[model samples]
Target: MLRAAMTGAIAAAIAVALAGCGAAPSNSGEGEGPVRVTTTIGQITDIVTNIGGERVEVAGIMPSGVDPHLYKATQGDIAKFEDADIVFYNGLHLEGKMTEVFEEMAEHKPTIAVGESIDPASLIEVANADGTQVYDPHIWFDVKLWMQAAETVQRELAKLDPDNAGTYEANAKAYLAELEALDAYARERIATIPEGQRVLVTAHDAFGYFGKAYDIEVRGLQGISTASEAGSKDVTDLRDFLVERKIKAVFVETSVSNRSITAVIEGAKKLGHDLKEGGTLYSDAMGEEGTPEGTYVGMVRHNVDTIVNALQ
Candidate 1:
């Protein structure tokens, strides 16, 4: 979830944590060797870097495990945007606070919103309690949709650097095939769980697409946006659902805090259900660099393994 509603105290703590850490300004030096590109998140960066190879220098604005919804651009990030030959963002307002900034930068450079290029009808829209639809920006949760997004990025990158079009297309095709295999693997792994226990309760509502793809029932403590508060009603409602279903485990996200999930555990305990920590699931962001879940494919595989081990 891109949006995070932080209390004043929490906001202050975050600010203090970020204080005095300076990132490099945008890369400069006009004499072109490799084209410079900027990505809003690590997933985009990884794909771009993979396809571009050594022909492009790519920088990711949001680090691994950082929440995109609440990410604020710093002075260093502005420089990176200004210097890039192309910019890639997840789109559908995933970079909630940075949307306006990216829009402004798009006027000066080639900017691609990968998610927006995918057909809207193909996307799964989230609904409010009254059933009104909002675009679910977490399309990467579904491997099929993510492959589409990767193609979109490949097309844009090829357009920007036509000299390397063949390489980009080939890499995209290979990566897409890997993504397809990953989807098959996830389906098989998830099938090992009892049919009735295919319920997935997580820290936030980021897994609607995952549920749709894998035939699992997904529930979350918070709404689509971490910006929203997890009220008493939300906790109570989830607690009742867990108890009714006799769910044994639930998940915590990589980027989001575990406070709300802890509340669910407590609620389940009071209701006589012996719930356990299912394991940490990578939700909003991938794992740390060089880890098994650092790349897109690795992240999905790790998620499947964690879910299967917990539920089986």
Candidate 2:
């Protein structure tokens, strides 16, 4: 009896995984008819859904907390991409692994890389340890940049669905105000952490804009992409830095595994520095669908709250 129950549970788990492998249905309003759209990240999905409201149906190719850099779309995801009226992505090499697929989709659909619309000068470029500069593609970390991205989405949505232009504009404006408020809240909360402890170390290099906006020093074990493996030297350097600076905590990312971070902690301990576990931070993606961190605004707020509470 137990064996039969275990087999059934395993089969059910496989079914759920297979289901999630495909694209989710459009969240369009009743009787509105299908107007397909696909987003790269859940945050963008939320923005599109908010402005599009009942007039449009939106689906995200990448699930919450999935690393966009390493996401591999299945056969079902490709089907959704082919059928989308518009494809919205946070370009600037963010969709590292899926860029080729999006490019191919652009041949057939009105795919938009929203981040590309932002002024290049406003973004901060990252450098390798050897000092060659690379563009930081995680612009959504900064509320200001995210608001700009949202506006771009609003414009594109308006262009596609002229009848709902007014609705989109109003929704975008309200959402932008919320983003502004979140920026203010982050600033106030982050100020509580002492200047000396304002260092943020995470699993990957996704918080350049967050560090710049909030005056925190950011460090990541891995590069911009989780696809890249961290070297022993990279771990050693971070371990030494944490010990030398006496940083109290280092954070774990929600999307990435904690192996690298745990290694860093152990290395630090061996060097006579004990580091605490800073709370889990939302990096490559937001929280689950219903929680406070599920929405874009809530995601940023939750990050700020977690960082402040842990570091301060």
TM-score to native of every candidate shown: 0.88, 0.87
In candidate 2, stretches whose alpha carbon ends up further than 4 angstroms from where it belongs are 1-34, 128-132
| Candidate 1 collision pairs | 2-69, 3-227, 4-227, 5-227
Instruction: Give a tens-digit lDDT track for model 1, residues 39-158.
Output: 987788878877777778988878888988777777677567656778899888677776656555555567799989889988877764335567888888888998888898888877
Taking the tens digit of each residue's C-alpha lDDT, what string does model 2 give over 1-312? 001012334334434543454354432333357567888898889889877777777888787778877665665675566557788998877776566565555654577888898999988877643456767888989989988998998898777677667888999888888888999999889989999999999998889999999889999988876767788999999999999999999999889999989999999988889898888999989899888888888898889998998888
Best by TM-score: 1
Residue 117 shift from truth in candidate 1, angstroms: 0.8
Model 2: per-residue Cα lDDT at residue 68: 77
- What lDDT does the true structure give each of the candidates? 0.79, 0.80
Model 1 regions more than 4 Å off? 1-31, 128-132
| lDDT at 113, model 1 | 91
TM-score of model 1 relative to the true fold? Answer: 0.88
lDDT, candidate 2, equals 0.80
Relative to the unseen true structure, what is the C-alpha lDDT of residue 125 in candidate 2, on a scale of 0 to 100?
A: 79
Per-residue error (Å), model 2, residue 8: 35
